[model samples]
Target: MPSASLSVKGRISMINFNTMNLRQENNIRRRFIMKKAARFLVVILSMMFLWGCELALIGIGASVGVGTYKFIEGKLERPYPIELQKAWDATNTALTNLQISVSGSLLEGAKGNIEGVRKDGVTVYISLKDEGQKVTTIGVRVGTFGDRIEADLVHKEIAAAAGL
Candidate 1:
């Protein structure tokens, strides 16, 4: 038969073993939680990095677009006519292509003439007035060498006519 001291000692050892097992389980649980938290942080950081890249790209696109617009605007000059018909044709094209809609009388009254001679060419001066009796005012001037500078010239003329 075991002595009382031996029995008490055995019971204490068993209790200690159980306590160690419980501690091991708790440690495993803590490690699992830490791993999940780490993964969550990585995902969040990745998303933020992607968003930052997209914003940077958008900024670059806007800068490029603005630069292109300014460059085109710089190349444009007022249209000059070599002949009367050329001046009249340019003016008519500008009026026809106008974005704003006005009455027939207003369109009819929009007239242009080869006003002066410049070193580059003939300067065609176009005018628009409210001939519609309903108080409609529209006018634009387009200058071109009848070549590649047409679109920008048209835009400048329209903007000038609209007082923009």
Candidate 2:
């Protein structure tokens, strides 16, 4: 038997209403929706991966699980194998040894922020965070726009002071 058809707006729509059961029509609609949803999910995941790649290129995103030294967001950061207190002391000693006058300091629980002013009048900020037992993360930034060389020097000084 020929399937019934209707002409609407110069387009012919075929309807096998008499041949296809309601369950079959419903299954077809469900499959279409599922396919569309899967396509959308793939697009979203691809966009996320691209964004992560951009961040990595700009030195702002690194694999957190690796615990490696990384330059991120205009700062240098590294995970040190030392306690929080020890890290804090090392940072302070480093600043002093470099003749950088500390302008401000804040220590709250497992996190610390130390701000200092160099002899050249450039400001520097050092941040320390406790990552785990006997593990601490240190970050160094110099001036408002970030001086990479100065930041690197500060990090090296901290490591030397800590004997790490």
Lowest lDDT 10-residue stretch of candidate 2? 58-67
Tell me which residue pairs clash in candidate 1.
78-143, 79-143, 79-144
What TM-score should be assigned to candidate 1? 0.31
Q: What would the per-residue lDDT of candidate 1 be over residues 1-164, giving only the tens digit for each residue?
A: 75656577789999999999999999999999999999999999998878736334323321322112222222322222123233344445554554322223212333332232233543433443332222222223234432234445554544444333
Q: Write the per-residue lDDT of candidate 2 for residues 39-61, one digit (tens) a residue.
A: 99999999887874734532332
Q: Which stretches of candidate 1 lie over 4 Å from their true place?
A: 1-6, 55-164
Question: Which residue pairs in candidate 2 have backbone atoms (N, alpha carbon, C) closer than 3 angstroms, thus clashing?
Answer: none
TM-score of 2: 0.60
Q: Each model's RMSD to truth, in Å?
A: 16.4, 9.9
Q: Residue 38 error for model 2, in Å?
A: 26
